[model samples]
Target: MGFEEDALLAESGLIIAPDPESARLTRTITGTDQTGAARDIRIVEERPLTIFLNSREIVTTMTIGDFPDYLALGFLKNQGMLRPGENVTAIDYDDELETIVVRTDQPTDFEEKLAKKTRTSGCAVGTVFGDMMEGLEGLTLPATPVRTSWLYALARTINTMPSLYLEAGAIHGTVLCREDRPLVYMEDVGRHNAVDKVAGYMVATGTDAADKILYTTGRLTSEMVIKTALMGIPVLASRSGFTAWGVEIARDVGLTLIGRMRGERFMCVSGEERLVRDADPAAVAAEDPRSRRKGSRD
Candidate 1:
């Protein structure tokens, strides 16, 4: 189905831009099945993207190779290296070298910050510096209410979209939504990478965060909670479960965390004060049967 412009604008009041298409998102490979049958399968392509801030090498991430520029910007943003409204002069990417260098007008020194790297629970290996949560204390999210009707519509639209996760088996999806409409959707090998891509996209487009919702296919971990909170997004929903630390941080930060969200069913572990039960539970249909994936039952 086409992304109706007026409906999206009315529902979310945001620019529903199309995800940049990439030719290298997937590749076909011949593989043998358990029955010894040779079949061609389309597999997602992952490449190492090493990010450099000016002259210093920052971090390397494995991603689906689509939107490397956004991935680089978002990675630095979430890592607390790139501050909000930081002036970026140039972002140079070398496909052959598998590296991206972000240049800014101001000098960036993170010798002490990088020294305190801590591993996170996100898949494909996630890391956070000691001061990553330093600015979260000052973050203030708007008291926007989330409607049950919006939740149902948002899930249905995201599930119907053609995504790398649905095409290939091993991928995670993160979507930026405004109530019932999804504005930007991104997928990557790691859930953190996907969220970073979305963060970068929002920064690039100057999207407002006050009334936005963040959706993910991965579980809610502390990293996920922190990243969403850093983005200044109040509402975060996941089709998967949540970790103990994730809920703790969400509660501490007052982020509206919703997990195990399948169709009409959802568990709001925190920030239930922001949920508006606008839709009648009986009127909402069960999750689309075709939308069921590996973690749909979770």
Candidate 2:
């Protein structure tokens, strides 16, 4: 399936349990209302998704259903677990077991790789520490210069992206792109999982890191930031916001952190140099209507 299709699949996560307090709510006509005919009920569902690396179960995440294969692959890539050319061969769902199995041919040294200490991360990536930070710090990203205008446009298009969010308004989404075009859009109960699916899709299709961009609907936590940096996407955009750590890591790694992208406004908190800044001296005057601003961050 394609991006929207994959996202739809991921959004179908299982509802594992119901809270007695919450389950008690129901919509019913009430005399207090003007029309006295409106009521609403709410319930939450959780699905168990297992990501397998070369048949070895690497991780399990609770997410709303849909893109199992992409979620698995994206998770691995961002976790610094996936390497180049480790194509995922198959994705199978055992309905009876209610778990997804992802198959890949990538070679791994799990015992050795997992030796590092772990730190708390947001979402299903509960804990991640780059024990291999030395090697990871050397990740070479291609010089894919994206303008601030393109960032603004991508953020704009992402708002209107077709997915369960637009259809159901109950899922998180992640989009993978090449310059102006959106290549993949994955959605799940969790934003991390959605991005993971995109990572998996990129690996399966041999998409290069230097040629892609990542977009999400969730806040730019450290995990999300690290994932985008690892994927070599110089810029990561989100509709939500970012944490202090997220901004810090992006600054250190030379990645751009763009958040609060909605309507016609956004904040470029870090890596402003990568963005296409206004060059017109007269426009600068219009921007400040005061002192002449410096042309560069000198």
Each candidate's lDDT (Cα)?
Answer: 0.82, 0.61
List TM-score per model, in order: 0.90, 0.71
Per-residue lDDT of candidate 2, residues 92-140 (tens digit): 7775576666666766667655566465455544545355243346564
Predicted structure with the largest TM-score when compared to the true one: 1
After TM-score superposition, the amount by which residue 84's alpha carbon in candidate 2 deviates from its true location, in angstroms, is 4.5
Residues 1-298, candidate 1, lDDT per residue (tens digit)? Answer: 2214433453454533324244478778999999999999777888899999999998888888877777888888888888756788888988999999999987889999988988888899998876657777856667779998998888877877777666666888888888787878778889999899888876665668888999999999888999999988999998999999999889888899998878778899999999999998788778768666445866
Clash pairs, candidate 1, are none
lDDT of 1 at 124: 92
Q: Of the candidates shown, which would achieve the greatest lDDT relative to the real structure?
A: 1
TM-score of predicted structure 1: 0.90
